[model samples]
Target: MLNRYNPHAMHQGYYRYPTISGDTVAFVCEDDLWTVPVEGGIARRLTTSLSMVITPRYSPDGQWLAFVARDEGHPEVYVMPAEGGEPRRLTYQGAERVEVVGWTPDGDEVIYNSTAGRPPREVVLWRVSLEGGLPTQYPYGLANHISFGPNGAILLGRHTGDPARWKRYRGGTAGVFWIDRTGSGEFTRFQPTDGDLTAPMWIGERIYFVSDHEGIANIYSCLPDGADLQRHTHHEEYYVRYPSTDGKRIVYHAGADLYVLDLATGENRLIPVELRSPRTQAQRKFVETDKYLQEYTLHPQGHSLLLTVRGKPFTMGNWEGAVLQYGEPQGVRYRLSRFLNDGTRIITVSDASGEPCLELHTPDGVTRFEAFDIGHPYRLEVCPTADRIALSNHRFELHLFDIEQRTLQLVERSEYGMIEGFAWSPCGRWLAYSFAPNERTHIIKIYDTETGAIHPITQPEFRDVLPAWDPDGEMLYFISLRDYDPVPDNLQFEMAFPMGMRVMAVVLRKDIPNPLLPPPRPFEETK
Candidate 1:
């Protein structure tokens, strides 16, 4: 029996998504991505400053690397010079919705699924050139994770035209199949096993897939001709993810740690390094530099957490920390008023006046402590230190307010587009803001308070938004959508990915306040 509420202690040894190649293996744990040598050496840190980086695929030539980065500005595919240079964005044409599923044999193009068209969306396969050219859509429909076999045929996660299967397929119980690049071939189902099959890896004539038929995810291998069934391992607790093979060993992530399985002997081995628990060890030492984990949780103190989750216009509201269902029929819109460090007084941007204004309130009375006639403070943001509040104004400029001094400081004066989200670094030294237009296309920018310099974190093409800072402020997580076509005839929203939500973490100067602010002050008796 456990006596303490230590969330970190219980989750110390879990690693995730391991990939092996010769002597090198890579995986992500607690949002940090790492790689190590297979000959029993220390693991090296790949990326720790971002909230989440997943679906990492090494180029066939082994000279380039690609992965999906869910940065605050967009969820797009990024490629770094294999030896390690700043990552270059590949797709910038769609919404904040896309996925990188397969790499072409030539290593010159990436195959991915995107939702570029309509609702009840279709996941269409699209290819982006590594050499930088316009993306071309494959004619197939309802497909995912496309892998080009040696013969140039594509292996895909089967898409059922019937709506019944769509509703029941969440725990990854989808069928794998083959299809041509053009929409002419019939959808032939691959495996009908009781377990859900996903992330299909094809090597020679043997088809390998990850399934959870025995109640735990594990790797299973079968011949493409549908013969010879083999169960590789007996490990029942850890989840087997992203099974990939170069016609040799099957590699994947076991509990965020990298692992490789020998096809000849059917044995498994763990990578030398383990990912630190996201709940504890906000930072950990790797072979050289330290890797950090990004965690997103509500600022437990209140006010700072607003839920615009349920609404008509969907304006913001304050998270008062307590669930009070009374008078105005509070909708999901919320904003950070004041924290306990100052008092229980909450501030919010509401449609009280003709134009939107900042309003302050307390539990005791409905009297207003402060009000500002700001236009459309859509994304209300507050800095925990220095008593500052910020909001996106009508002209697409970010307006900062000094709550105590009653002065406004223009932190970011931008006319680029509407601001989507903003977060302060843990140490309050910098601010990260994501912006896009009402129609969906934008940029995520990072500003240094000390140097007054602005760094654009994303490429100009993809629409990225929703930046959430990791607990340690080392990474920021946002959504990215790509593969856009502006032709009205081609614009059908047919590319909507089934996996819509992605989490990213950006490295920040430091970690911010959790259970934010000090405790609330005791109520004074009014005589």
Candidate 2:
């Protein structure tokens, strides 16, 4: 049985899209609808459907709850009693992507936004009747989050970019605007700023919204005419998102806790919400190792396969041997493990030292070394002679590290794009990598460590990648997209593939004979 829940003691799970009525707040927790008191108390589950439900909005009268649910494979608008009961489907033509905006002033219809017959960057607002009927689209062109104002005026917050993907963005599409629904279809910039603004809530004569103008996102308020701007919350750590108002108080999520700001007193307090549902996912359970496998690589000598599963490095025999696990400390992540030249040590990028650093695991012990000063190391390749290591970091800058000398060299800074698929020559004298010169194609380049000179191996017109050094160091092998063999498609009246890929070998020296050419017959000295 589940234990008695206490709101002040519980602090787990993600809560989103909160809408407050008189004193009760409806929100989504772990893809399920739930309700909790505004003064902080235990939450009661409202819906138990297996499908995901989100974006719950309360009716103006506070008797009905409207939300978007994917119970029937596609997201549709559903309305149920605010106190919890059977939900009635209102929109049959709901698309896979839909959001519950708010209810009409009369509470007879629930307004929502859908991507049906519209581009991904734009969504049209549609209002569906609570009695179940077709939804009517608003005359708006491109609006994501909207709030109704006096005289049929709409405070439109155009798509301000995805909050989950980008942060602190001040691009072109970053601020909110206003549009008049009953008049000409024209949008005017409201509260113009370089920061990203979203979640506009029109309460009385003031408009409340969240913006990252002062670094971190915080609650700010301005008049309907876009004057007398004031910042309500002074949050500088995490962004305040998904704010809702009941005309008296503003409730928003900051980090993992929900906070409510009293408009009159400007007092912000945490709304401790305790979940009484079963902790099925938090409970300890054995997980199958096979399904959690992330990466695998063959050993240099083909003796065993190195695998990284759930951020733990392990080695399993290719034919026969007991599995060996090289587990690190808690909260540390290890990636891209490769065998060293001695075959007794493994080099990998690990965050064991609180930051991403190069680590060498040997039979004796593990050794840590800082690889970069700015960005974390991503992919690395150990030289054949074990003298140098070529690696690229999160900043897309390639670097060469000398192990014995404990020195680092800036190989090259890729201005156009990321440098990828790099390999060290057999003699460890040069490094070959690929980078895109323009937006259309990639070219191969070689960097000589001894001379500190760089040279281009392939032209920028063709794309080349996956470079490998021929064991003798006389030729370099790479894959290029030069084959233009097109295959006609039967289903569509067009060519399926206009170009393919083929492996090409380049002789480093001009005196070296072409490997693809037939070998000349052995002749006597007379010739």
Candidate 3:
């Protein structure tokens, strides 16, 4: 069976690192690539990696997508079609912490950042051809996220302070913004400030970057020569993170929502993204439960076993048979699962509706009974003949529950220790069980439903325990130490009754005569 969630449910998660091309805004979400319209409508997923995809950049022609995916156990460069398809790997150096900055203006190579040199301390920029080859290192020292100017210049952003990390960090190591007025390697700081500045981009003639000089991270722009510094956005609660532009409009994410800033009209509006992807990782994952398995109960028919795996109920079959796992809502813990008589419905004890209850499930739906007032149950057995169930709790109490009326009635309580075993009669009117009265001796007793009387079937002198009813309900079987065959020890002055245990049976009705006895008495020559 396919486990699927609500496809029509619309929710907004952390929409991060958006790059815009035309009216389509490609972004990173759920650790995969997704694209939504700038006008804000239903979003479509591009990749199914679920493997920490970051920094998606659109090609200049808006035909291909370049991003970084760690699906292969490490971050590497990968590119796919803008409309969603199988992504082809471009970089396979097995380098650590690779981030795709952006694509070259010509759309022939992808630019990214990684550790450089032998020891690899300072981060530098490298570009790899889209035709699959080794990446060539860019000459500028200490440059990560770089963008090409409209007039063939360089707008390189160095390390920037994260407002999400350090709120008001204005000290050194904040960030350094470098500008290359020409294509030459010469670089200089663009309007030095004490605040953290990152996410640099070059749209048209303005140099845009994120800064926190005003105590809150927002988008700011300046001319190429570091003149006319102006703040464009006024975000107060959350700092801006990873803003990208498509030479016309800027797409970025701040706080938990995505925002689009139009450089032409200077209008920034919040884009309500309708993100509803099949997040399989959140629903399915590997879990080691061999050491965590606490209990398992074999079904009465021997076709399956009721298992409490990590406090959840699952039914498993023998050898290549199917495994049926019951589903529960989020944050609900279910335990102690069993099948009712006839094996049509499953019964489970859960705390789902803010209180402890007994949940009954079948093909139709679920039915809950909140009057299940038992605590820490050790055994939950449904009567083999009726809708009633037998429950034994840690409080040394036995409870009788009605399935139809949703009522709980106390059957008995053990003052010395817990009730060892219980078996319901075929008529569902009698319950036979064994319990120790004082730690020294245990006896079997039967409770009659028609008459409110408890009858003891064995003497207290003999420790009779674990009474079970025959299929006919006319006889009872128990284990006792009545038969004695004492033997003296050779090395010590002690005698041990090694052959004392014997299976004992009691006939309830004297009318149950065995005709096969006395050798059937058929050879009397009555003919």
Candidate 4:
């Protein structure tokens, strides 16, 4: 969450897609193109379009700027004066993504990659002349990151860089950097190691790129033949992202701050580009909150609804009355609330103190308690008796919290998986839940609160889940995938269960008879 909005609050703007042209550093922030001096100071917004501007690149002569912006649903290439002016749309590819790679070395055309005229996943490079007209594709079919060098030499990266999705990613899809020294349509793979290699920039004689080979992503440089391998910009926390060069300096962003790395002196510095515009989006505005409403339930007596919205947990009156939102700490998220047996008290989970805690909201005030200071309570249900509550966190543990005692009891720590689909018996003494023994099977388990004993009533061979108890507490009902009627796949050599689910029941006591067993006579004979 952002802090309270102050129009004059001059904090450094969090920007991305940083490109350098001489002493000017151009980047996109707040959905607008912004420029500031390389020495770092107050920034100025370049375009008033206020669209999704990204990947801004400066022309070789530093006279024109090319970028991608989306005014409608689709993104297209656009160009404008290097300083600031009205942007001119360059590409008319309707529903494809256009990412600005850079301008040509001669500054006559802009180079970009798009999914147009190809498969949705296959991206190829294209060039549009500055004088307008149709765009033409490069000779290569599929490539992502490309940087041109002097005398027709080029560096190609197989994939673009993204820190959020591909940080420390070591898989088959991980891109490899390649170089073409002759520009004769022959490209060979360089730096064949297994790391997320991307954002290749062929600066002068050495090729600079971002890689996580040292377990942390940083800017690294190596000879065109994949030697030397000098590591620059040792960022241990945030990965260096989208490093673009303007012949002398490399501009990229790590986390939210823009940084510049000089090629000759090896100097790295943060560009503190501050903003002065009113951040209306960051200001707290009133919302209907129905859009963010989640996990709602009726009141104990069907008078109102207890629900959690984007901000906090609140109650809405069914007939007439003002909506009551419980007083909570700002930025604390609450969920899964229910009216206690008292019909006036509410119990839910809150991350107020930075961890999950049981919060009780009553007519007087609010009180909170934690369960031995562990586990995040995402699933919660009030016992019909209302003295106890059942909690299940992401740690695969089930707990019982006593409202009066303010104590937590570790009822069961599931050894295999989560203890979902739990139900409190009408008597509130036996809690029935579906517990998994392995990844493939779930068995109904009953826990006796008074006796502290557990009993598994179902077999492991059958996959069962979602346990519900009868009102009289004599039987427990569940759904089981016991019937495996397999059907062979039409496309491949595999089988799938078309209809396997069946309603299952178990008699809780030895004196009760199995309802599923037959009477000893056929239906017609009995009739």
- Top lDDT: which candidate number? 4
**What C-alpha lDDT does candidate 4 achieve relative to the native structure?**
0.82
TM-score for all models, in order of appearance? 0.48, 0.88, 0.53, 0.81
Best by TM-score: 2
Candidate 4 segments whose C-alpha is farther than 4 A from its true place: 1-9, 92-98, 115-126, 131-142, 192-194, 284-286, 362-373, 406-420, 440-444, 456-527
Tens digit of per-residue lDDT, candidate 4, span 169-253: 8777676777788777688888834578888888888888888878777888887878788887877788888779988999998
lDDT of each: 0.60, 0.80, 0.79, 0.82
For residue 114, give model 3's deviation from the true position in Å. 0.9
RMSD, one per candidate, in order = 21.2, 4.7, 17.8, 5.1
Steric collisions counted per model: 63, 0, 0, 0
Off by over 4 Å in 3: 1-10, 116-121, 161-163, 284-286, 289-527
Which run of 10 residues does model 2 get worst, by summed lDDT?
A: 1-10
lDDT of 3 by residue, 229-294 (tens): 987888878888888888887888877678888887788888777877666666877788787786
Scanning candidate 1 in windows of ten residues, the lowest lDDT window is 288-297
Clash pairs detected, candidate 4 = none
Per-residue lDDT of model 1, residues 1-527, tens digit only: 10112324332444555555566666555565566666445555676546577666667766666777766566677777555567778877654556666578777888777776634356777888887678888776677666655555556775422212232344443555664433345556676356666777777666677766666766777876557977775555566766666557877765544567777666676545533334545454444211221111133363343222222112123633453321145433333333322444455654444445565555674433235546666566667565666677766777776667776666665555777778777767678887653355666787776787788887666677777676676677787666443333345645444444445444544554333359666698567
Evaluated at residue 480, the lDDT of candidate 3 is: 86
For the record, the alpha-carbon RMSD of candidate 3 to the native fold, in angstroms, is 17.8
